[model samples]
Each structure stands twice: as C-alpha cells, then as structure tokens.
Target: MPHNLTKQPRRRHPQRSQYGLTLVELLVGIAIGLLLIVGATSLFLSNLDASRRLLLEARLNQNLRSAAELITRDLRRASYWDQAVPKMGSVDNNPHQGITLDGTSDISYQFDAPAGAASAAGFALTDDYRIRMTIGQTTQDLTDPAVAKVISFNIIESKNKIDIGMQKIPAATPNTECLTERRYDITIEAEAPSDANVKRRLETAVRVRNDRVGNCS
Candidate 1:
C-alpha cells in the first residue's frame, strides 16, 4: 500500500558539460606562441651583427694609429746631421745629399757625422750615418740606424712646397734657419693579412733638417 502512493522516478539522459577548447582556439594559441619565439630570435641576431662590426672598426683604428706614430717619429728627425761639419757621401751614384730617395720606395739619409766620436749635445751625427726607411724587412746593424717598421712608404713631392726661410724665424734664432728645404708628402699604409677590412693609412709632411739650409750657401 505504501509503494503504491509513491510516484515512480523517470530515467533521463545525462547532459554533457562543455569544458574543452575548440580546434580553432587551439590552433590560434599555437600560432601566437610561434610569433613570440620568432621575434625574440630576430632581435638577438640583429644585436649580434652590430657588436661584431663595432669590434672590427676598433681593431682597424688601433692598427692604423700605431703604424702612423712609428712613421711620423722617424720622419720628423729625417736627415738630422749633427753639429759636426757635413761631409757628403756617395749614395747610389747620387751626390751625398742629406736625404736621398731614388725613385723607388727606398730612402737613405744621414743623421750623424760620417767619422767621429759621439757628440755632447746628443744631437751630433756619429759614424757618418743615421737611418734609412724602406718597404722591405728591417735592417739590423750596429754601424747603421734601425730600419722603419711599416708596410708601404710612398713619397709625393709637391713642386710648390713651402720653404722655411730666414725671415720666418726670430731675430736671435740660432739653429732654426732653413733656406729652401725638401718637402715630402708621405703616405704610410699598413694592413692585417688575416682581415682585409683591417687596413689603415696616414699622410704627413716631413722636412729634412740637414737639407734645410741648402748646402749652407
């Protein structure tokens, strides 16, 4: 009797919960992740290239400056004949000039006296020679001055060179006299064989001190 009063429960189908992502949503998320990765990679590569170029430029400048210093120092002291009397020597069949450049890149000049002891002023020429600069290897000699350290030496002689005259000097100037000196427009260049980009050149004007007064009249 009790069971007959209770109503019977009806069976019903269970509803499926929609919780998973759609195929399109999954594909979009993957595409966005790929873009982020690609952007990061591109930025990294760009920075790397810039850093490499800066390093290369620095190397080139350093090499160039070092080479220039070496050349200028010697050139300024070119043809420095000490206080001793000048005695000309025969250089390659040419007159014993203070500075000698024989068409080629080879240059020889006298800084000290030809045959005499060292001078007290420390500016005297000794043993009839000073130094010579050339394109080839450094010449090692006790009788001669040291060779120049450079890759190439090119001399450009300007016809309208400025001649430092007596009027240019002060009234009491002692050794600052030059009648008509030789003016040399020189270009010194050097390069690293390993890297073609690492090359440098420098141009400077050098006046021969011994050639200043032009045979002292």
Candidate 2:
C-alpha cells in the first residue's frame, strides 16, 4: 500500500478576538458626562438669578403701594364733617415731608387752623401755622455690595401738578360741627427698577378730615 499519508482531518482552532471598549471610547464617555454636568449647572444658575429678580420686583411694588395708601388715608378724612376744602400749592422743598410719591422730593401739606379758642367769639378766627416736611428718595443699588442711599429731596415746585379741592364749609359757633373737610392733590412720579427708563407714577388727592373753618384765633 502506497504510504500515502492519511491526511489528518484539519483541526479547526477558534480565533482569539480583542473585546471590551478601547481607551479612546472610555475617554469620550467621560468627556460627554462632564459636558452634561456643566450644561445642567449653567442652566440652574441662570434660572436662580431670574427668580431672585422677580422677587425683588414684587417687593418694590408692595413698598410703593404702602407709601401711597398711607398718605391717602390721612388726606381722605380732610375737612371732617364740614365741607371746607384745603388750599393746594407747592412751597420750598424739604426732604422729611413724607408726602411725596416720587423716590425724591421735598414738600409739605399746609393748612390754616384756629390757634386756640382765645378769639372764639371775636371777628378774627384761628391762627394757623404752616407745616412743612421733606420728601426724600430712598434708593438701593442691587449691584456691588448692595448699598442703599437717600437721594436729593424736596425737588419739585407746587405748580407742577394738578390740585384737588372741595367746597368751603360755613363757619358756625357753639353748635358748630367743629370739623371741616378739605381736598387737595399730591403729584407723585415713580421710577421702576428695571430699564431705569420705565417709570411708574402715582398721584394721590387727599384731604384732612378735621379741616378747620377759617382762622379761629
């Protein structure tokens, strides 16, 4: 028999293959995670700044309303039971007036009243003294260290605004109602925080409830 070598069946060997992520892929995944975290953090911080500004706006609005209403309440009762109205005119500016609606102004509410009952039955009536207070501006700079400043006061003149009025009350004695009613106007100009260009204004017409009838002194 020809020694033809019995060909041995070729043995099949499984090929060894490389597996798992490459170094490049691992580095890419880490980079992507870092990017995501940075983006998310940026968005959150921006939202927080916006919310703070809104809250600031709301508080400013409330403060303005409070100042307006408080002043009006006192003026509404002007002239009391009597119908005598008050005189309206701007005098020299004062910072403590507390009647101005604008952040800056100095003005006073003036009216005549009986000095006392000294001349009660006499021809001359009350001896009224003029009262004046300054209206100043209160400003806070949200930037920097967040400081507040009081700007100039008593800046506007009396003729710059509309005047309010009421009918004069008839003066009487003994049985007199003792109280008079007066009406007048106070003009206010406000400035909004954002866009310093936006202006918010408020004008209050008020009267003292117990306005006196003429000079009683």
Candidate 3:
C-alpha cells in the first residue's frame, strides 16, 4: 500500500481557566456588603446621640449649681448691716432697703457696701441684671446682653418657722431681742437657649443675717 503523505492529526487537549462569578452570586455579595454598611452607620449614629445627651446634661447641672451657689451666698449676706448701723431706710439715700418680703417672682435686697465701695451691692429682682459683681471689686450691668438666661427665679419669704418641706431653718432664732427673722425660699429654673429639654431646677431656703434686726442700745 502506498504511504499517505498526510500524517494523522495529533490529538490535542483544551485547557480550562477559572470561571467568573454568576449573576446570582454577584447580587448576593452586593446585598451582604450593603447590610454591613447599614449596620455600621446605625451603630455610629446611636453612639453619637448618646454622647450629645450626656454633654447637655452635664452643662445643665453645672449652670444650675453655679447660679444656685452664688444666689445662696448673696442671700446669707442679705441685710448685712455692720454690728451697729441704722436699718436700711429712706434716710441717707441708702439704695438697699432691706429685703423685699413680697411674694414677688424676683427678689431685690440691699447689703452694706464696704467703705469706698464703687456702687451699692445688691441684686436686681429681675433676671435682667443691671448690676454685677466683678473679681476686681467693681460692678457692671447685670442685664448685659451677654448674660445667661434665667428661666425662672422666685423668692418666697416666711416669718418664724414654717413646717413646709421646702423650708430651711436657721441655726439661730431669726429674731433675737431687738432682731427680726426673715426666711427665704429660693427657687431657680435655668436652661440653655439652644436646648430646652436640657434644664435644671433648684430650690433651697436661706436665712438673712440682719433681715430686720435692731440695735438694743
């Protein structure tokens, strides 16, 4: 037999490569990634809200306490007339004329101003401060635009001892000999302008040192 010129075709194997993701697999992976992102975002928002609330609470408490302490100190010194001095009155052009015992929403009282004192030492009944205490021993406008807001400030006065739970009894008899006793129920409400929910209320009693005392001469 005559040999065929054409050689038999050699057998060849086709190589297989990795296949790409199917449509269903790609969609499932995208869905999982979205869920993770959503969860992370929610967690971050929750933490942020909690932190803001805490900061607001702290600010409210601080403002309330500071205002309370200052008011209390002033009340204790109310009507402080040196050991022997005529009671504050219309005479001598005395600006501070004892504590106003009316059930007013605000309180106004006069305290002895040290010799050579700049202005009379006193707090206006209105939250609008027309007078302020300075570290340099000076006075300034209390109602200045920069002043903080006082939502509510009230001074309730009582004579002798009242059994009311809101009362604060004095260590000594309010009135001794020629002295008269004046008890004060102080209530204050404060909040920042930005946040109404964050607020504070404080109530306390203070006894005036020389409310209506007289010299026994």
Candidate lDDT values, in order:
0.48, 0.38, 0.57
Candidate 3 residue-wise lDDT, 71-90, digit = tens: 67876766555533553322
Superposed model 1: Cα runs more than 4 Å off: 1-21, 84-96, 102-106, 113-153, 159-178, 188-201, 215-217
Error of 3 at 208 (Å): 1.3
Candidate 1 per-residue lDDT, tens place, 121-149, comes to 11111232322334223443211112222
Model 3, TM vs. native: 0.62
Tell me the spans in candidate 3 whose CA falls farther than 4 Å from its real position.
1-18, 83-97, 101-103, 116-121, 124-149, 161-178, 214-217
Best by TM-score: 3
Candidate 2: where are CA atoms >4 Å away?
A: 1-16, 77-104, 110-217
Error of 3 at 126 (Å): 5.2
C-alpha RMSD by candidate, in order = 10.9, 13.1, 8.9
Q: Give residue 185's lDDT in candidate 2 (0 to 100).
A: 62
Give all TM-scores, in the order shown. 0.52, 0.42, 0.62
